[model samples]
Target: MQADNVTRTFEDPMLLQRIPSAFLISAAVLVGMEVIGFLLLCEKHVYEITGFSVSESTWGEANEVPSKINDECAENAVMSNKEMTPLEALQTADFYLLWASVCCILVPQTMLSSLSKFFGLEYIRDDSFLAGITMASSVCNAVGRVIWGLLGDYLSFKVPLCCLLLVWTILLVTFPHLSGFEGSHLKALYSLWVCLMFFCLSGVFVFTPLASNALYGSRNMTINFGLVYSAFIIGGILAAVLTRIPQLHGQTFTQFTIGGMFCCVAFVLCLWLKDPKYPNKLKNLDVFFWFREYISLRCFHWSLGRYFRQCS
Candidate 1:
């Protein structure tokens, strides 16, 4: 056999370094101490879910079906199902609407996460507890990414994601009042609530890319999501401007309220996305139906399998 003297080049190379276990252990211990210190000093106050009685009326009016736009498919006319050219996708009204809603939703998270520890320390005069809240929120941020990614894969992304926004909106709207309460264990709730907010925010990071890939095509996912994600930069700038407000000026409430309203708006926009099944009609905007459909899908598969086994 002749000896060959050729070296293979890799198109993509990964760093082969391994993180030290000692460093990981030390970091974990430090973080655990920070969290424990926060919890130990945390004021015990009663937590209550204030405002809004849950009823059909509490959920707002039944969704109005938009008038069907004339499809009038011209012979060989390109449709949404066809892979969209980047320019064509950019020009569509839906994409920008989604972007605007995401930008609005992101502003609150950016501002709140940046200010959470400051807010807690200023109010309670406990540094450790507030630091703990910050750490918990960061951990939940990672948790939310994993959870929402799995959710998107198991259930199509749009509807359940919107429900999460609805829940997040409710939490944001009430957070200011609840956290500020003096005697109630509400302060503890505040920490948990902030973590949930971070959770929702992190999920959006996962969802936006998936949404872009589904709505446009995977071929364009990189550029399309990049354009959508630019909204985060815009959101961050808004957060920076918001910081100019004096802390005593009810700035926290103002920020949270704005975030809550934007989340609601995002939910509404999510309802408008055209369904793949019903070409003429818009997707059913019923939040309840979307919640139930996944369960129904699972049951249907189970039944079908049972029938096949019985036949065999």
Candidate 2:
């Protein structure tokens, strides 16, 4: 779904423009967080939200499990870990962790790229429902790539990222309120919301691994991307911690709050970012426009460097 050629072109300016250029990868990560958060808001999306909502809604009231804190989960009165045999407990815990991992990583990386495609299968959510949204997402995704790519080319990466983050902020924070609407209005709102969600996700096009190089610096291409990719796993691990709190169990609010907060952090971090200089983009917009940007404060021989120098 992400294009390397396009990413390469914008990498220079993106790295130069600290706001959006820096958020390129962060946007992808935040989107994953967004999906996790959105899922938390909908009971239909997560079987775990029931427990989380109950727990968070009544913070004082203990929900079945009493010792509800990280690492201390075994101390809880209900379903105490002491009851299980070492092997049985380990197996159960392993499965729980594995499933949590799937929920975390899959929702962001795969769901955005492929789930809708699968939803298109006849046996899935009634070919009628999935077909429309899935097809629309794919079509819009293709169109957005060009539009966003060009924007990254001419304008600052800040424009696209801030707008996307702002929209994402609304999406993450207000998603819960949407449920208040009734009937076809609710469905229509949800449909439109989903489209907007996809729109923000297009930020990934600008922030792909190819783009990461220009923003961070191409000198350490392999290492930078390697570290960035690790974020997915790390984010997944954090998701587990956020979702499986003993009290909240698996609530939509847990994920949503976490995602909302993460998005804010990404946005803030982007404020300090700068764009990389790649004059080639102007000359060969056809070629470099679609290429990736490898970024680093040191790499930008442009405005971003001047800002860093002044800050120091």
Question: Which candidate leads in TM-score?
Answer: 1
Report the error of model 2 at residue 28, Å: 27
Please report the TM-score between candidate 2 and the true structure: 0.45
| TM-score of each candidate structure, all chains considered together | 0.60, 0.45
lDDT string, candidate 2, 160-204, tens digits:
655666676667666545557765675566557656667667765
Question: How many residue pairs clash per model?
Answer: 5, 40
lDDT of 1 by residue, 51-104 (tens): 957577745543322234244332112332456667877887668866876887
Q: Lowest lDDT 10-mer window, candidate 2? A: 72-81
Q: After superposition, how far is residue 8 of candidate 1 from its true place, in Å?
A: 58
Q: Could you report the Cα RMSD, in angstroms, for every candidate shown?
A: 23.2, 27.2
